[model samples]
Target chain A: MTMIQIRDVNKRYDDGFHALKNINLEFRQGEMTVLIGPSGCGKSTTMRLVNRLVSPTSGTVEIGGRDIRSIDPVELRRSIGYVIQSVGLFPHMTIGRNVAVVPRLKRWDADKTARRVDELLDMVGLKPDLYRDRYPSELSGGQQQRVGVVRALAADPDIILMDEPFSALDPLSREQLQEDVARLQQELHKTIVFVTHDMDEALKIADRIVLMKDGEVVQSDTPDRMLRRPANDFVRTFIGQKRLEAGGAADVAEREAGPDLGGFVMADGPTVNDVMVTQPAVTYPGRGLAEAITTMERRKVDSLYVVDRQRKLLGSVSIYNVMDSYGDEDKTVADVMMPVRYSVQSGTPLTQAVELLASHRLHNVAVIDEDSRFIGLITRGSVVRHLAEKLPHGDNGEEPGSSTGLGPQGGNREEHS
Target chain B: MSAGLSFFEFLGERLPDLLLALREHLTLSLIAVLIGSAISLPLGVLLVYSRIGWLNSAVFFLANLLQTIPSLALLAILIPLMGIGARPAVLALLLYSIMPVLRNTYEGFRSVDPHVLEAARGLGYSAAQRLLRVQLPLAVPYIMSGIRLTTVYVISWATLATLVGAGGLGQLIVSGMGVNQPYLIVAGALGAIALALAADLLLGWLESALGRRFGLRGGAAA
Candidate 1:
C-alpha cells in the first residue's frame, strides 16, 4: 500500500529558488525509499514535503489518500518521525527525557512514557539504567545519534524521515548504524523516507533508491535494479562505475552459485581499516603483571597489546605469561610480554590480512598507522563476521569464533581502559 | 578627626531620616524595574516573532534614544507630564531600564540554537510550545543577565529622584551639599552604593541558580 504520495509537487522558496520541480513519488508501507542525489538536488526538500516541513508551491502531498495541508502541520509531524544529520538531541534534557519528547508531547501518562523511553533506549543497545540520567553532551557522537534515532521512534510513528542521519559519523559507526537501521526496519516494518548523498549508504539500507539531480528524480528503482539497469548516464555516473559493475556481477553470481559464494564477488573489497576492530584490549607496558592480568580479566581477553603512552605498540602479553609471573610481584608487563611478530598497515586489503592470518595460524594481527600507533586489530572472528554481513542472508549461523584458537575471547574486545 | 567623630554623632541623630530615605529609594527602584520588565519582556518576545522589520528597528531605535537621554534631563522632561513626586522619578528610571532588559530578552530568544529549534518543530512542537518549552528555557541565562543589569541601573538612577521631590537618598546629598555638610553627602552616597551592591549580589545569585537549572554556566553574555 502507498503510505505517502507526492503528486506533481513543485517547491519554490520565497527567494525565488526553485527547489523541487514537478516531482512525483510514492512511498510504500514497510519499505525504506531512499532519496539520493548531490547537494541541493531537493532530495531533502522532497522528504520535508511529506512531514509538511516544506510545503509544495503547486500540487499536493497526500498521506493515506488525504492531502497533508488539510491536517494541522504540528499534528501531522507528530505522526511522522524525523531525524537529522546533527542528531539534535536536546542538550539540556537527560537521555531518557530526550527519548520521551514525542511521548510527552502526545500526553502519554508518566508510567507509560517512562517505560517506552527505557524500551526504546534498550532497543538501541543503550542500557536505560546507565544512560537515562546522563545528558547528551556526556555521550560520544555515535551514542548521541543513537539517542536521536530512538527519540524519533519514541512515539512509534509508522513513517520516519531521515535526512542524512548517519553521514556525520565515522565510517565504522556509520556502517554499524546502517546495519542497525536495516535490522530495525525488518523488525518494525515502518515506512521510511531516507535522504542521503552517499549512494553506498542508500544501497546498503534502502529497499528503493530514488536518484535525483537538479530538483528532479532521474530514476526510482530497487537498489539491485538501479545498480544493474541505471535509467541514464547521470544515474550511472552518480552510482559510480565501480559499484555498478561489482553489484551487477554479484547479482549474477548470487543467482548461479547461491548465497555462500556471494561474499567474494566484489573485487574492491574492504580494507583493514574498514573491517578491523578499532578498540582492542590494550594496556601500558609499565603496568605490573597483576595489573596486566586484571586488565585482561576486565576486558575479557586472553591476550592484550602492550603500548606506551603514545599508543605505539611495543609487544603482546598473554594471560599465560601473566600467570607465569604471578609469583613475582616485582615483574612488570615489559618483562613477560612477547615481541609483536605479525602486524599490518591500516589500509592493507582484508584479503591479504585474511591470507596472513590463515597462513600464519595466528589468532589476530595488529593494524598500525604510519607512525606505528596501534590503531586496530583484525581477529579471525572479525573477518568471519565481516564476510557474514556481506551475504544476502546476513545471519548465516556461522560461529565467528569456532575456527579461532582463542575461542570467543578473540572476537571484539571494546576498549574501556 | 573632630569632623569624622561629629559625622558619627550626626548619623545617630538622623537615623530615622536616613532609614526613611533608604525605604523611598528601594521603593522607587523596585516599582520602576517591575513595571519596566513588565513592558519590555513581552515586547522583546513580540519583536522576536514579528515579521515587520521596520517595527523591530523602530522599537530598538526608541530604546536607544531613551538610553542616550541624561537621567536628570529625562526627569526634567517627565515632570511636566507626570508632575513631581515618585511618579516622575519612576518614569525616568523605567525609561532608562527599558534598553538593557529589552535588548537582552531579544538577544536571548534570538540566540537559541536554530538546530534545536528545528528539531523542536520537527518533533511537532507548536509555535507557542517551542517558545515556552525550548526557547524560553535556553534563553534563561541571557534574560537573567538582562534583568540583573536593569535592576542595577534602576537602583543607581533612583538616587537622583530627590530633584523631583521624591525624597530618596538623593535628598540627603542635595541638602548636605546646600549646607556644606560632607558627612551627609557621604552617608547618602554610601546608602545608594550599598543598595546597588546588594541588589546586584542578590540577582547574581538568582541568575547562577537559574543558570544551573537550565544547563548554562556563568550566565550568557549581556
Candidate 2:
C-alpha cells in the first residue's frame, strides 16, 4: 500500500524562509525510511506536516490516498502514532493509562483496552506488572522512550512518525532502544518515518535513507546503495565524518559509502561518488557466520568489509572470521576479526615494495591522506615494487613512513568515542 | 494613644457583658458563609468541567446579582421572614461572599488539559469518576482562591450582624459613637480588619500546600 506520497510539496513560511521546496517522495507500507540532514534542514518540518502539526505552505499531503486536508486533523493525528524527543507523555497518567490513551479515545472497550496495554508494555520489554501503574516521572529516559513508543503503538496505527527519539540517551541506551525498534518493526510492521541529523543512525534503522538539506531532499536510497555511492558532494562530506571516536569502523562503513554506491568506486581518476561503488560493502559482526561464506560465493569476492551501523570500517571479513566464529553462536563480530590492518593511502608513490613488506606485515595499505574521503588503496606487491625500480629510497620517493599513513598498526580507528 | 492600643481597650470595656449576644453574632456569620461555599464549590465544578449550559448560566447570574446589591440593602429584603437578629445577617453575608469563590473554582477546573481528562475517559471512568479522578484534584489551587476570598468577606461582614440586633463587635461601635467615644468605634474597626487579614494569610498557605501535592501535571503553570 502507498502509505504517504508527496509531490512537489513546497512550504514557504510567512517569514520568507523556504522551509521546503519542490519535495517529492513516496513511503510504502511496512518499511522503515529515515530522513537525515544537517540542523536547519526541513526533515523535522516535513514529518510534522504528515501529522499536520505543521502545515505545508503550498503542498498537498496525502495519506493512504486521502488528501490529509480533507480529513479532520484531530482524527488524522489520532490515526497516526507520533513520537518526539520529549515523548510528550501526560505526566498525570499511569504507565498503563498512557499507553491506553489513543485506544480509549477511539473507544476500545474495557477488556480490550486492558489487554492492549498489557501486550504493548510487554512488547516494549516493560513488564506490565512492574511498570504499568507507575507515572512517567518514575521511569528512566530510555524507559520513558519505550513507553512513548508503546503509546504510539497502542492504537496499532498503520503509520508512525519518530523524531530523534533516541538522541537524548547515552550510547548504550541508544543502541538498546534501536534494537527495540528493529525488533518492533519485524513484529508489527508499521510504516515509519524516522528523522535524525545523524547519518549513522539512519544507516542503523533505515531500510532507505532520504538525505535532506534546506527543506529539500538530495537523495533517497537503501543503506547498501547509499554506502556504495553518494548522490552529491554534500552527502559525500557527511558520508564518512567520524561519530563515536576511533573505535572499530563498523558504523562508518555504511556511512563511508554514499547513497549512490551500487557499483564499485574505481579510483583510476577522480570520479564522483555517484558513479561507482567507492568502497566494498561491510557486513555486521553478529550476522550469521553463514554470511561470510554466502557473500564470498555470490559476489565472487574473497573478502567483505565488516562494520557496525555507523558505517565506520571495523575490519574486513576474509575467510578468517568465518572459520573462527563458525559454530559459535555465542561469538560476536568483534571477537573473531583482527583489528584494522593492511591499510594504505590514496597517494603513495608507485615504489617502496621491499620496505613496505618488511615494516607492516601486510600485503597492502591504502594510498590516501587524512580525510580518507577518496583515498586509493596501494598493494605492497604492486605500488612498492613499481616505486623501488625508479626512485631512490632516500628523501623523496613517498615519505619514508609506512604505506598506510597510520601504518597497518592503527589505520582505521572508530569514529565515535 | 499607646500607638492606638488604648482604643481597643476602651471599646472592649464599652461593649455589653451579654455573652449570648456576642456568640449569636459570630454564629450567624459562620453559618451563612459555610452554606454559601458548600453550594458554590459543586456548582462551580459543574460549570467548568461539564460545560453544562444551565450550570454556567446559574453561576453567572448569582455572581452578577450579588455584586450589584449593597450588603445592608440585601439584608433588608430578607427582614420580613426571620425578624432581625442573626437570620437576616447570615443570609446577607452568604449571598455577598459567593461570587469570587464560585468564579475562581470554575476557572480552575476548566483549565485542566483535555488530554489528561481523555486518559480518564479512555480508562472508562464514569462521568462522576472523571470529575473526581481528573478535574477536582487539579482544580485545587483555583478552588482554594475562591475559598480564601469567601473567608475574608465573611469575617468582615460578621459585624454587620449587629444592625439586625445580633449584637457583634458592631454593637460597641454603635454605642461608642452615640456617647461621643471615638475610642470604642476605632477599636471595632481595627478588630474587623485584623480578622480579615488573618483569614487571608491562613487560606493562602493552605492553597500553596495543596498546589505542591497536586503539582505533577505541569503544576507551576497551575
Candidate 3:
C-alpha cells in the first residue's frame, strides 16, 4: 500500500526561491525509504512538506490516498511522527511529558497517556523509571534524540519522518542508534521517510535509497542493487564507501580465492595445527614490513607471526615482507600487510582452504578448529599445486569474491598485478 | 522619636492601623498581579506569533509604551478617573505590573527554539496546537518568572497606593510622615519591605513546587 504519495510536488519559498520542483515520489507502507543528497538538494524540503510544515507550491501531498490538505491539520499531525537533527525535546518537560504531549493534545485520557509515555520510553531502550522523570536538558545529545523519536512515536503514527535525527551524535553513538532504529523498523514495519546527507547512514538503515541532487532524484533503488550496480558515476562515488575497501574485498573474500592457490596446497587433511607456526616471529600489524623483516632477518625465521591483538596470526609474511623492504619497509602494517579477513579452522577441506588464501592473496592462512583454537596453517604454494591437479579455470573473470577458488592454473607469486 | 511617647506606646498606638493597611496592601498586590498575568500570558503569545504581521502594532506598542510611565504619576492619573481608593491603587499597580509580565512573556515566547517549532509542525500540529503544546509549555518558565517579578513589584508599589487614600500599610507611613512621627514611618516602611520579602519567598517556593509537579521550569528560568 502507498502510505504517502507526492505527485509533482513543488515548494517555492516566499522569496520565490524554488526549493523543490515538480517532485514525484511515493513512500510504501511498512518500508523504510531514505532520502540522501547534498545540501540544498530539496530532500529536506520534501520531508517538511509531507506534514504541511512547508506547503507544496503546486501539486498534491496525499497520505493514504486522500489529499493531505483535506485532513484537519491537527488530526493529520497526530497520525505522523517527526524526529529532527536537533532532537527538539521540550527542555521544560520531562521525557515522559514530552512523549505524552501529542496524545494529550489529542485529548487522550490521563491514564492512557501515562501508559503510552512509559511504553514509548521502554521501546526506545530507555527505562521509564529512570528516564521518564528527567528533563531533556539532563540527557546527552543521543539520549535526547531518542526521546525525540519516542515523542514522534507516541501517538503510534503509521508513518514516521526523521530528518537527520542522529547527525549530532558521535560516531559510536550514531552507529548504536542506527542499529536501534534499524531494529525498530524491522519489528514495527512502519513506513518511514528518513532524510540524511550521509550516504553511509542512508545505507545502514534504508531498505531503499533515493539518491538526490539539486532538487531532483538521480536514482532510487534497493540498497543492495544500488551498492552492487550503481547507476552512474555519481552513485558509484556516493555509494563508494560501502565498497570502501573495494578491490581487496573480492581478492580477500573466501569465495573469490583464485585457482592457483588451490593447485599447490597439501591435499591430505593436514590441519593448520600440524604445519602452522605458534610464533614464527611476531610483528605489530603496524610498522609496515620493518618489524616483520627485522624479525625475519634477526630471528633467522622464514616467516613472522602477524598475530593481531589476540595473538592469533592474521597471515604470515616471508619473501613478501622482505620484497618491499628495498622500497620502504618502514611503512605501517596497515599500508603494506595484505588486508585479510579469512582464517580457516583445522581439518577443513583442502579446496575450502585454497579458496581462502587466493581470494586474500595471502602466502599462507592460519588454521583453527571448531572451538576456533589455533591449529595449523596452509600455504598458496601447496594449495595452488593441489587445485591445478583438480580442475581447470573455466570461468575466469566472474570473480564473485565469495567463491573459494577461481583463478588461472599457474604458479602463485606475491605481486600486485 | 516622638517628644512624649515611649517605644511601647509607639508600637501599640500604630500597630492596628498598620495591620489594616498591610491587609489592603496585600489585597491590591494580588489583584493587580492576577489580572496582569491573565492579560500578559495571551498578550505574550501574540506578541511573539504576530511578529508584526497579522495585527496592528497598537497593542504591542501600548505594552511597550506603558513600561515608561512613572508608577506615582500613573496612580495620580488614575485617581481622578477611577476615584481615590482601591480602584485607583489597583489601576496603578496594573500599569506597573505589565512591564515585567509583558517583557518576560514576550521574551519567553520569542526565545522558543525555531527547531522545536519546525519539529512540532512536522509532527502534524497545527499552528494553534504548536503554540499551546510546544511553545507555551516551553515558555512557561519565562512567563512565570515575569509574573513573579511583577507580583513583587506590584506589592512593593502598592505601599504607595496608600498615598491615594487606599488603605494599606503605607497609610501608617503617610500619616506618620504628615505628623512627623519617625518611629511610625520606620515601622510602616519595615512592614512593607517585610511583606515584599515574604512574597518573594512564597512565590519562589510556589514556582518550584509547580515546576516539579507539572514539568515546568521554575520562575523566569522555567
Candidate 4:
C-alpha cells in the first residue's frame, strides 16, 4: 500500500529558485525509497515536502490518502521520524534524553519514555547503562549517529525521513550505519524516505532508488533493475559501468539460465570468503628450501604459505625464492620467504578484494579472520572460475562496455595480454 | 600612618550611615537589574522570532542610543519625567542595563546551532518549545554573561544616584569633598568597588553553575 503520495508537487522559493518541478512519487509501506542526485538536484527538497519541512508551492502531499496540509505540521511531524547528516543529537541532552525527546513531545509517561529510550539504545547496540547518561559529545562520531538513529525511532513512528544522515561520517562508520539501517528496516518495516548523493549508499539500502537531476527524477527503479537496465545515458554514467556490470551480473545470469541456476544467485554481492581457496598449499617456515619447493610442486602452486604450528601465516615461499637459495644448504623457508603484503578481512566484499588485487597487480591476496589468522586465499583463478560458473556461457559480450574480472583498464587485462 | 588611622576612626564613627548607604546602593542596583532583565529578555526573544527586520533594527538602535547617552546626562534627561531621587536614578540605570542584557539575549538565541534547531523542529517541537527546551538551555552561558555585565554596570552606576538626592555611597564622597575629608571619599569609593567585585564574582559563579547544569559549553562551544 502507498503510505505517502506526493502528487504533482512543485516548490519555488521566495528568491525565485524553482527547487522542484512537478514531482510525483509514492512511497510504499515497509519499504525504503532513496532520493539521490548531484547536489542541488531537489532530492532533499522533495524529501522535505513529505514532512512539511518545505511545503509544496502548488501541489498536494497525501499521507495515507489524507492531505498532509489538513493536519497541523507539528502534529504531522510528531507522527514521523527525521534524521540529518550532522547527526544533530542535542549536545545539551544525554543520549537517553535525546532519544526521549519525541516521546516527551507526545507526552508519553515518564516511566514509559525511560524504558523506550533504553530499549531504543539497546536496539542500536549501545548499552543503555554505559551510554544513557552520556552526552552526544562524549560519544564518537559513529556512536553519536547511532544515538541519532535511536532518537528517530524513539516514538516508534511508522515513517522515517533521513536526509544524508551518514554522509558526515567516515567511510567505515558510514558503511556500518548503512548496514544498521538496512537491518533495522528488516525488523521494523517502517516506510522510509532516505535522501543522499551517493549511488552506492542508495543501492545498498534502498528498496526503490529515485535518481534525480535538476529538479526532476531521471529514473525510479529497484536496485537490480537500475543496475541491469538503466533508464538513460544519464543514469548509466551516473552509476558507472563497472558497478553496473558487477552488480547486475548475478541477476542477469540467473534470468538467462532460469531456476536451475538459483543455487549460484548471490543476491547480496559475493564476499571474499565466497570464492576464497580455504585449503591453500602451506609449508612450515623452518622447512628447508628443498622441502618448500617440493611442497609447491606437489600442490601444483607457484608459492607455498609458511605457517607456524598454530597455522598462523608467517609469510610465503615462492618457487623463485627457493631457486635463489637452493645452493645454501642451511637456508630454511623463513630465511628466504617474502612477507605477505596484501590481505583482506574475511567478510570483505569480493569487488573490493578484487579491486585490491587489480590495483596492486597481485596474483592472490590472503584472507584473515578478526584474529589476523589466515583463513583462506582469494586468487585470480578462484575469481575467474567463480565468474565462469555463474556466467556459464561466457556470453557477457552483449553489454556494450562489459569486461570480466576487473575492467578494460584493470591489471587482469594486462595478464591476458 | 596617622591618615590611615583617622580613616579607620571615621569608618568606626560613621558605621551606621555607611551601612545605610550600602543597603540603599545594593537595593538600587539589584532592582534596576531585575526589572531590566524582565523587560529585555522577552524583548530579545521577540526580536529573534519577529520576522520584521526593521523592528529589530529600530529596537537595537534605540538601545544603542540609550547606551551612548552620558550617565549623568541620562539622569538629567530623566529628571523631568521621574523627578529626581531613587526613581530617576533607577530609571537611568535601567536604561543603561537594557543594552547589554538585550544584546546578549538576542545573540544567545541567534548563536544557537542552526542544526540543533532544525533537529528540534523536525522532531516536532513547537516554536515555543524549541525556545524553552533547546535554544534557551544551550544559550545559558551567553545569557548569564549578559546578566553579569548588567549587574556590574548597575552596581557601579548606582553610586552616582547621590547626584539626584538618592543618597547612596556616592553621597559620602560628595559630602566628604564638601568637608575636605579624604577618608570619607576613600571609604565611599572602596564600598562601591567592593560591591561591584562581589556582585561580579557571585554572578560569575552562577554563570558557570548554570553552564554546567545546562551543558552549555558542550552545545555552544562544540
Q: Evaluated with DockQ, which candidate comes out highest?
A: 1
Candidate numbers sorted by TM-score from highest down: 4, 1, 3, 2
Tens-digit lDDT track of model 3 for B114-190: 88787777666777877776777666677777788888777777878887888888887888889888887888888
State candidate 3's DockQ: 0.37
Query: Best TM-score goes to which candidate?
Result: 4
Give fnat of each prediction, in order: 0.58, 0.08, 0.67, 0.71
Task: Compose the digit string of candidate 1's lDDT tens values, residues B92-186.
Answer: 89988888999999999999879888999999999999999898887878888898999987888888999999999999999889988888899
Scored by TM against the true chain B, the candidates give: 0.95, 0.83, 0.86, 0.94
Stretches off by above 4 angstroms in model 2 are: A241-417, B1-222
lDDT of 2 by residue, A1-417 (tens): 788998678888889989999999998899999999988899988887888777787768898888999987677777888777766566656889878878877888989999999999999889999998888889998999899888888888899999888887755456678889988999889999999876656766888889998888998988545644567667665554422222214433543454533222221222211111234435677767676667654433344566666555566666555676688867655666666654444333333422454465544443324543323333322222122211222223233334344221111211110
Better of 1 and 4 by lDDT: 1
Model 3 TM-score relative to the real fold:
0.71
lDDT of 3 by residue, A110-139 (tens): 999999998888887899999988988888
RMSD of each: 9.2, 14.5, 12.2, 11.8
Ordered by lDDT, highest first, the candidates read: 1, 4, 3, 2
**iRMSD per prediction, in order:** 1.0, 6.7, 2.2, 0.9
Cα lDDT, model 4, residue B82: 79
